[model samples]
Target: MTGVQKLENSKRNKIQAYDLAIHDWYQFILGYPPHLVRHYIEKFGVSKYDIVFDPFCGTGTTPVEALKNGISSYGLEANPIATFASKVKTYTDYDPDLLLEYLAYIRRSMESSYSNYGIVEPQADLFSYKARFCTIKVKDIINLTESQLQVIPKGFISPKPLLKVLIIKEIIRSIENKDARDFFLLALAKFIVKEAGNVRFGPEVGRTKPKSDIESIHSFTTIAEIMINDVQKTKLTGQAQIMQGDARSLDKYMTRELVRGINCVITSPPYPNEKDYTRSTRLESVLLDFIRNKRELRGIKENLLRSNSRNVFVSDNDSRYISSFSSITSIAQEVENRRLALNKTSGFERHYNKIILHYFGGLYRHLKTLRPYLARNCKLAYVVGDQMSFFRVLIPTAELLGEIAESLGYRIKEIELWRTRAATATKMQINENVLILEKK
Candidate 1:
């Protein structure tokens, strides 16, 4: 089947089996699939000489895909854990044999540690049945700081599973090699979310019934082996540079050589919705030490586009950037009117209207700030979804983004239909589109 036909028939968001190498190692719950990146690369006629940039490079989907196709890429991300994941996923220099040796050492360490503590090794069948059969006491395990404990949402990870995670985490950190240590940590992060933690994602991060004990070591080893296989098969022909920083002012992270060096762009920035985006990774972020305290967490949120009420602050002035756009202001006003009519007086309810303005305003600054770094006629694709999250008010994200890009001297190439998803609030199908643009 043709590429267009395949995209039309296939589920656009799912990671296909063929594209599951480094991408499956770590990913955002809502990130676009690697095939979508390939589609844009081919559509834009990208080559090894070109550099693909993803400003909101959540978990390095764009960069990893670009590197796999022998194309150089650059990425910028605000979330620390996501940045770490991106760096680890795109790194191709790790020795798989060394990785195996490290895995062996980690296994030995875990086994010895458990044996010394008189704790029986958790059986594979126990994890398979999702049973709470283990007799491990939470008080006996190593604990995180009160600050760290406070950051993780309550019940997101039960005490027993958290203890197992902390135990494996200490073992992984003891690896002398930084690269191997990071690789093992990434595997553990996956294990924390998918295997050990009570967190589940049905498009939103929430808690499930807690598991008393999990086969933490066995599960982590399996995850590490999968990563090792991907690393072993990797044949990198191009380089990737990933930076952890706000996308609104990405120039700060750009080196002199990268000025106007970007040839194409493909990314999915955070949509304007109620989803915090941070909560989805809170379990691993806190356990892995990416976010250690409330202050550090707030700092990370400050760097992101203020798309939700949780991240919006009183001092924010991003909304002022697009104040002249009547279309945007009108929508914000409508949202406020709807909130008032509904008698919604909560603090977060008050920020609902402001999120609309600040969200687009942040994107406007992002586009304007990114102008000088784009090569002449550089093609770009922003995979954005429409939202009815705030009082069921429709926010045409791709269309507004297209207008903002045009205002910043980018030519709108097309607003292609990527897919459609059901709005969580209204349960109505909303269009998720790719706003294509070219540098003027």
Candidate 2:
């Protein structure tokens, strides 16, 4: 296939088997595709001078991937649910009976739970709704008493994440269907923003899956029972360490050992996509104690990057930058012309331009923030795409990064086409690409 044809073909196949793939829907949803982290490490290669980091750190993909290669790495995530999920992937020890131990923990607690809610624990519609939405059998859990709920066993002592995760795990363990369980986990994790009332996916595709309240029929059996399976499966050279902190100010949370002698940096910060990372993780945030309370999370909507107009990051004059897209040497202008040819509102053209500039500008700021911490001769890679807007291609991610790095005393090394866009993606445009940079 030609580059365009290859890109189109890859979309339908999800292009996971190819070299450009960083992740897939199955591994996130079903665990069928294997982990992409190991693949990333092998492709990029790590060295003793490398201490990697992912600023966005969605579900800890980078950190978890880093761990397999035994490379010391760091991650920062604003989304509480995603941050926590990433931690679970990192902490899960594939020791024998680890799953069984957690299973036994729940069984003992379930036995006593019979007394917590009393005989009529469940509300009228609660049973019906749970039956429809969740993978677990709600009726079985409803019978547990208040005493059982009150006295959380040692394994379930967290009292917070136990019930929620249990609702899903019980179904995964007990359900005979493998595909259903896997899909359920992905759907559940994806819905966490919505299920837990957190943020939703932005216009960009890599922001992880969208907020979905519905349940899928996929299986949950251990596709790969081993913990850190992604690491070994893909063949990598570093281990992952996911941490929590504000990227604008990363020095506070990251240790000196973690940041010292880092060779490369790779990540994508939040685009201004009207997505409130705070609201998206709201449900999981409350259930997981990732946040103390709803009140503390109230202002998180304000913390998002200016890429989306919904956040505080944008200014009234931001349209000036949006207008500058008229200058790009990209395929986006054809998109605008096509829309105009159709006599459409085509407002997305301008909005997308604003969004793109907002995204790249935010990335530029973050790149500057990260420059001080990276070791000499570091390589930086970014996965990005071009969105058509108002007869212009908005900010060029690679060029913008190059300019920012040059301004910060770095050099532009390589800008290569990583993977062709999958044609079937309803998420965004087909201009999926990657950027590679180096510090001077």
What tens-digit string does per-residue lDDT give for candidate 2 at 255-304?
77765756766665553333444543443444334455433453454344
Q: Model 1, 1-440: lDDT tens per residue?
A: 43643765347778888889899998889898888999899999999999999999999999999999999899999999999999999887899888888877777666655655565765522233221122223454457889988988999887667766777777777678998989889999999889998988986788899888777667787889998998888776688999999988976888875795799989999998889999999989999989989999999999999988899998999999999998899999999999999999999999999999999999999999898999998999999999999999898999888888889899998999888888897789899999999999
* Model 2, total clashes: 52
- Please report the candidate that would top TM-score against the real structure: 1
Candidate 1 runs further than 4 Å off: 1-5, 8-10, 124-142
Superposed on all Cα atoms, the candidates' RMSDs to the truth, in angstroms, are 4.2, 10.5
In model 1, which residue pairs have backbone atoms overlapping below 3 Å? none
Output candidate 2 Cα RMSD.
10.5
